[model samples]
Target: MSVDKLDMQSPDLVYQNIEKLAESFPNCVTESDTGKAIDFDLLRQELSHAVVEGNKERYRLEWPGKKEAIVTANLPTTKTLRPLLKESVDFDNTENIYIEGDNLEVLKLLQESYLGKIKMIYIDPPYNTGKDFVYKDNFAKDTQEELFESGQKDEYNQRLIVNPETSGRYHSNWLNMMYPRLKLARNLLSANGIVVISIDEKEVHNLRKLCDEIYGEKNFAGEIIWKNSSKNDQDYISTQHEYLVCYVKDKSINKGNWIEKKEGLDEIYKAFDSFKKKHGEDWEAIHQEALAWYKQFSESNPIFSSKHYSWLDEKGVYFPDNISGPNHGQYVYDVIHPITKEVCKAPSSGWRYPESTLKQRIKEKLVHFGKDHSTVPNNKTYLKNTEFQSLTSIRYKDGRVASKNLAKLFGENLFTNPKDPDLLCELFKSFELKENDIILDFFSGSGTTAEAVMKLNFETDSICRFILVQLPEDLNETLRTASGGAKATITRSIQYLKKFNKPTTIAELGKQRIKLCSANYTKKNKPTIGFRVYRLDDSNMQNVHYKPQEYAQANLDLFSDNVKSDRTADDLLAQVMLAWGLPLSLKIERLEITGKEVFRVAQNSLYACFDKGLDETFAKEIAKDKPLRVVFRDNGFKDDTAKVNVKQLLKQLSPETEMKVI
Candidate 1:
């Protein structure tokens, strides 16, 4: 016997698999002096003909920056989300979040707390249309200098690059931006989670291969063709349809719950109700009359031919299905006619069930018969059997509808090529999500996903939450300052902001749109209608930048306070939300306890005070509130006497409270 050890080199799944095999079949694994590497020759003898060789090359999708993408995924970020108190609508009582930051960095930050927590993720990354902006991790020196001069991008510390048509590695550039983000996103998905991505024909093929490699090929959910709008001005051929590629975390566990639901088509149901009233409970007769009217239902009708529901019963309208199976097998049998005391003829193939099964269905009235025993029976599948239709791969709708929706919300065309909220609602509702679940959208351009989730929740009364991450790509200042221009789209929104004297940015547009949409589309049944805003920036805590050689006692005074000068109580509270993984929208109540304003988060989840005028009375009053967690600025104490006694007093007053200082 010899000792086996793991390799110190970076992970090798091959060796790990061998080790797992050795556990169940120890006699086959022989150790060598070099390491725990598997003795394949010996193992081969144990398995005999069942042994497989791995020396041959295997097929895999690879690109120029694939290795770098993997490296990028493993790297961590040192950024924190700072709360923009004035920007948030309901700073105290909302669970929805709108984050302003680069999504890749944001994903890295969320990987820890939100791992395996998201129910679904839908992203519409740039479609690489030669003009679209794509992120390149390469921190170009020239871009840095330009950013340092302008001061807009210097704080972000990354450049947004465009992989224009002239670039030789056009496809490779997109793969780089998406590869790492997808890798991180897969970690955030719960065991039964999924990711839906929207892409055009240009990069959809490559995007599928990328997702296949990241979220295993077996978990590949079907791709949906969004047949949105038509193009009569096509130079060669009309490529109006785009694609939505879906992938699950692990197919074996996901169980395709989404396969059972669809968006609510209210108009058709309303029309059905009208017909149901005109005629009586004679379901078939009323449906026939409705179908006749639907046949002449104007060709210019905006919706799909929802009137195709041909079969009807006491329950609802449905399409009749075939009841035959393959040649005389287990399902082959004779079915007795419902009225006549005679057997009904079966198809040459056979009935789709055994005699006993046919008898049970007949007893349950699921079997629909023709006029007599000579006629074959049909299957009556009720429409209500599954309220949602099986999602068809192809979808027909107008893509321009999204722009029109945004135009209405913004009172002008404030964005370029935004996604339709209706389409996003359909994509998300496909998951059949019930109860409260979190959705993450990293590429949250124009806040379309947020608006979609909001509308879906309002309509269904389902509390599905969302986390939208968008990069604060600086607005072209010219557009913001423009008085008039044919190309200026956000002129009206800018003027609206000017009245309020708001700081102008791209994130401002998304936040304002969501606010307007929330106000306009708010449902009375819903409790909350706003989102908490957080910006990616340096931490509120200031570091001293230790210099080892400086042996001066006076320098210690400079390090007395660790909190940044410009930071506020709200700023610290926001960082606490990030560190604790609490929803920033959690309700916060500010109460002045013994002259010190203490902020209580969501009914005493935590109590914090950054006030400098703290005393022993502050602790005693806060303890009376009996919060679960308490935090304070170290310098807030009047002296060391109060600082030392505060924790002890809190222990006795609210013994369960965990106390800490910044």
Candidate 2:
């Protein structure tokens, strides 16, 4: 029952060293032998001034393909996100995003635009049970893998391959799949960013170790024990709980994080106001009645509860909470006992605030007195006061709420065992998030996180955006009707149906859930309930990929003007946006100047003109407004004279603009 220390293999030291090197000098490190080795000479050259003479020992996480995973994260990807205007709702204004593709590639595409930008991330990933299928890293794909990547066109199952428990590297494969994505994910986090991952008992320990390596041991946030369900059927103890491991980008940034518990106050406060209006004349009886009500209150009646209420007056029910702990803060003059008409005792330590605060509280009638003059007065916290509660490590929520709603909307068990949206909202609320802050979920299964963000915003009345990335991995057998069963209450849609015999991926299901939530969550006063959709795909450019051997004059000339036939100018513009580090959700507008299509992003953050046969006039026109970045087709120049003139003119006009050709 114990591990064999000697028999177990240690991690590759060389790869560990390489990964450490790449962390500092990502630009210097280059992939060698098709991403199999690190070009150390090039790395050292890039860091020539600060190069280390020899290897220095340090504590780190090592795995079989740890170095390769680092390479994959650092490697430049040509992939781009194509806008799905037809499938999307409120394509221009909505802040939410639902992306369809492999998360690894999606993360790579997001690296530049989203680096140090995310505020919160919540992902529920694969649990790696015996029948689980993982992402096959294609850094060194073979012919079989290439075929699998091709999607087969007929077989729906080729995209996913099961890793049985009997396999020698069962856990290893899962780690490899998760490593690079998480590494890339880390770059997208802001200084105060946090990522919460929902995991099961099978991989909780392993996930913690992995997160410690990626997010650093010092930034290890607490984990939440979530009661996923209440099941009585099991051989042993019915495993009803799951774990949510959270990590912060930096610990110092969470100085003022808090969530106000407002559940039991809202409706009760309204009722109390009405009661006060009727009995404002007889404040003493009303206060007595409120005290009696609090004494008989049970948790079952959630609408009215005075758990924090201890003192009642004309102002209503409230508790005398210590302004400061026993031996803390500054002391002030003695506060008189209202009933005894005598000086009250002071705290052993002191008053919570200075004389100014005491005077202010007295002016506001916020000080509660003791029975006699011998007792010290405490700060009165009213029932109307917002009580900010600390985030609990243990959470109890019935996950069935999400499942039942999904069943009602989809009319079938589409996504099994979804995390409770209300629970997720509570977790997100604990962060005290704001309007500009973003919440990302790369593993956005069933769009629960998206709905949570929406519901949270609806309740808090904030405009926080959400970025949801979900793989087009098909649903498991239980949710599919491909085996010749009853018709899915919903018919199949999207081009995936043509390529896949049985059409449907987890992404499609998630998008549907988001739509349903947006429309149905509110009966009236419908908020901005919609999202923009983007799909992960190959580069819009033609097949002339950059390579050492193909870097020739003739090769460049032959393929210079050729872009993929299936792509549009908008597609090229999107690729340009990826190349430039601009948020994909940024506002974009199209303009036609001099009979050429021009795309402007975020007013002036970036500009793209994919028009061909460009002359000095167009360049000067675009240069009039010195945008941060300007992209054009390589062959857009009419001639060498025209190109030189355009460059010179642009420099003369918009010197701040960075101009580049595709």
Q: For this target, which candidate reaches the highest lDDT against the unseen true structure?
A: 1
TM-score of 1: 0.74
The candidate maximizing TM-score is 1
lDDT of 2 at 637: 79
Residue-wise C-alpha lDDT for candidate 2, range 489-536, written one tens digit per residue: 223333333344434666777877787788655546565587889888
Which segments of candidate 2 are over 4 A away from where they belong? 1-68, 146-159, 163-168, 267-313, 319-381, 409-413, 476-503, 520-527, 546-559, 639-641
lDDT of 1 at 638: 88
- TM-score per prediction, in order, is 0.74, 0.73
lDDT of 1 by residue, 1-662 (tens): 99899777888787788679879777655433233446566566667777566555468876677788788888765567787778887767777889998888788767655878899999999898876667776432476575554444635554576567656467778888999999999999999998999999889999998988999889998998888877777778888888999999988888885553433335445666678887778766776876775555524453435445454555565555688885655476556786796978878788788778878877887877766899888778765665666766877677878888787776677776688887778766778765678889998878898888987887777888889998876555434333343236655555666776764556777888888888766866655587888888766768743221121122322335677888888887776655555655577889878877888888989998888867778788888878887877778788888888897899999999977666
Residue 440 shift from truth in candidate 2, angstroms: 1.4
Off by over 4 Å in 1: 1-76, 138-158, 232-237, 260-379, 389-392, 477-504, 525-528, 543-559, 621-628, 648-657
